[model samples]
Target chain A: MTTVAPETVPAAPERAERQRGQPRWWLYGAAGVAAALGIWAILAQMLAGGGGAIQRLASPLAVGEQLASYATDGMVADLRSSLAIFVAGWLGGGILAALVGLLLGRVTLLGRMFLPIIEAIRPVSSIAWVPLSIVWFGFGFSSKVFLVGLAVFLVVIVYAVDGCTRIPGELVRTSTMLGMSPMQRFRNLILPGTLSEVLIGFRVGLMAGWGTVIVAELVAADAGLGAHLMAVQRSYDIAAVMATMLCFAIAGFLMTVVFTWVERRLLPWRLEEQR
Target chain B: MTSKEAEALGKTTRPRTGSRHPLQRIGLPLVGVVLLIATWEVTVWLNDLDSIVMPRPMEVLRALGDLVVSGEFWDDVVVSLTEFGSGYVIGVFAGVVVGVLMAEFSVFRATVHPVVEALRFIVPFAWIPLVILWFGTSLLGKTLLVAYATFFVMVVSAAKAMQQVDPTLTKVGRMLGMSRWRLAFAVQLRAAAPTIASSARAAAAIAWIAVVAAEYVGASAGLGVLIINASTSLQTDVVIAGMVVIGLVGAGVSAVIGWLSRSYLSYV
Candidate 1:
């Protein structure tokens, strides 16, 4: 990992070329996947219910079978509903947070007045609000959306506020000294200043929103993956439950992948830093 | 504790607020609270909302007061504590063991790291239904869910901390003729302790959230159970009260972790 002098920079590619002799990472990674499956298979065998229909732990293959079934089953509707709830909640809360965060960061009077209250509420986990949201919005999409939004809002607001307030004093002074118009200052200074932090907010908010959405759905949803999970769980179909979880994990991973891709596109300089 | 907990410390402030009058420092926030309460009460009055639809601030406070004195609330709190404590300990212990293995052995890193990383994408709450099916509506299922939630964060943090141990220090250990295990435990793990321990704060936060979700799955007793029951019964005040209690406890846990990290643990 140590870097050589500028003259040695031309040799770096050769060193990387020589690294082809090293063990391939993906081979080991595939081994890792196989190992995980093997372990699950062993657990399923060990925990298999008495010769009958019940199996407490579903084998990886069984879950795969269930997932295959989902290709022609209700997974689409469930995924769509879940994604819809997640997107609405995440974006709605994120936009609101950006506004509130900017306000808190800029206005001393308002910040002083509301900072403590926000702090007090900050520690409350988003899941704790699920019941209250249900009480307020009832057992429907709105309730789940509110719950997710609230969680995302709380998570993002911190970043938003920090983004605005943490703009360097010198930067502010320089912009002011330039006699820039309000819109000019906002365009040239504020947008770039807050973009990174606010994006980080969105990233964190996504996790919070996703988690809350699952909890909300589990509690009382007519549709969505969580409700499907509840139905299968009550039926004691361990394979289906595991299959549903696989769907969830895949979805979560895809969302993260999308975010990382978006981040790289937006923050190309970060990628350059590595090279 | 990472940026999340650091931000939770709320250290950022207007540059000039430090020298502000103490009276104004506290009074301004109090005014905000008063306004919030006024707005809540006014909204209820304006809507002529039913208690089930929306509880007034006073009603929530009264419910909270009652919860504080009630044995049921205490019992639920005890159940939650046990579930969180046992599950977190198990998850952290397992995670650190596996993480250390990955650090010390390339085979482990190759075979387990990617698998764990892939699994980490799944929210722990998603496992609650599966665990319930496995262990039923008992404490074990709840504990398993919390543990599942805690495992990934700790594993990643522990591995990262171990890997980040100063290479020069390890070389020094080798020069001193320390055994491999001795070097790992005495030098590497000790160096990694602060980062790993700081990670506990974040894992604990996740564990707390998971515990609520676990209880929601099918626990007979918990803050989550209380909230769920109240919601089902259309007792909005009690539900809000439960939320307040959960929030207070969650904050207290964070504060306690912050103090521990500050006082007992030193960063390498």
Candidate 2:
């Protein structure tokens, strides 16, 4: 009982309170953003000169107008298709990696035997797999999904294996002494212990999957945000390209914020350690 | 120590299943890879899959050999390596400087933080269209794309590292009569080196990936170009060979970074 005493846990509340007092920080952040935008607008105007606007760099105002127009256009469908591929690949890759990682972590011999093979393939960039995936599945939704899954799988597996292997020997020993069966111990301790790390892996995998989906779409696709981007690029519509990029940036940001919120709610104990 | 004490210590330290021999540790993974190749070959043979869809392992190996013997392969490799190296170096240098400035100056930090945060959400691939438009498939374009990707990654990590430096260390340096510049260079930078080194490694990997993506989109020469060209011509074997080369180069770069971190930045 003495060994299990919570020593540093009490300090977290005070630190959290200190962070809560920082209200002026938001104003400063907003001011900074405003200044940056002003500078960007001025720079864009300067770069565009008078007559022939640089077809490469679109002015901020032009991009903004395009963004507004696109909002009324087929932006929603593009987003939905991209998100569908991203979510499917992320879940498929993450779940499969977690299960395989758990098995490998529990069996030392299997880890030793197969880890090198896994490591060898992990460095192959997801973009490198585009040709093979296209050849296998053709130029369709499945090919992009396969490419995204392949991209995410390696990252998730690496993190999942790390999480599983890092379980403390002392915890296992203590549970064994308390007369817990191996299966029960695994259920109660190992699974819960690995959840935090697996979630982190999932977050990383999600970002990688998102990037892969975009790359996959760029190669060969009829729809999706990437295909839209390619179309604009071919037409030399700089403003449209910028608008599409902004869409990607915003979607990615919102997804990450939501993920962080979920992760925080699910793993309350991790907050103190993070601080 | 007594023999009994030594035995108890050994019991505590050793794994429950007993330590594996070195040969088993290394040889088993090799065996696993060989088995995988064998399985792939057998599956292709049994299914009678077209070489266009999936080239046999032997054909891939032959393609790899031909690539090595050809001058074009060397040119592509050299171009890719140059882009990766130059972009990585420039990105790391700029990122570290900007990150240090942000961490040290509140005004700078507040001004840059919002823009950086917003831009970070855009994946490197999303910049391909703009990059091509701006620089037009030139070496400079590819290098800038790689640098852009690396810069954002390294800046965030470096800034975090700098901010996490213990305030007490700076105070101690001041007490010892160190100048502001001296304290920052000698104390804060040293303390943050390990974190910065790790971020640099990550940036290196991202740089490699960015270069490939750039080349894929609009490059006259590179491994990515080879892959794209070969695939279009139904030269699946050459495509696989290009992939193998890319993977090997990536692994080599990572290994070099790992070695450097272990040898120089292990203090943290």
Deviation from native of the Cα of residue A15 in model 2, angstroms: 12
Q: Give one clash count per candidate, in the order shown.
A: 0, 0
For every model shown, what is its TM-score relative to the native structure? Answer: 0.90, 0.91
lDDT digits (tens) for residues A1-275 of candidate 1: 21211001111244335434565755876888987889879878987854332247788889999999986889999999999999999999999988888888777789888877887786677777776776677789899999888888877888887888788889888988999887898788877777778887887776667877778888885899999988898888889988998898788767867886787789877545545
lDDT of 2 by residue, B1-268 (tens): 0111111111111123433687886677777788889998998999999999889999999999999999999999999988888888888889889888777766576567667767777878999988888778888878788778878776776776777788799889999999988998899988988877876776777778888888888889998999999999999999999999998998799779768977997676
Instruction: Give the chain B TM-score for each candidate.
Output: 0.88, 0.89
Please identify model 1 stretches exceeding 4 Å from their true place: A1-23, A50-55, A272-275, B1-19, B266-268
> Compared with the true structure, what per-residue lDDT tens digits does model 1 show for residues B33-130?
99999999999999998988889999999999999998899999989889988998898899888878877876567668667766776778788887
Task: Give the clashing residue pairs of candidate 2, or none.
Answer: none
In candidate 1, position B54 carries an lDDT of 84
Model 1 chain B: ten consecutive residues of lowest lDDT: B1-10
Candidate 2, position B1, lDDT: 9
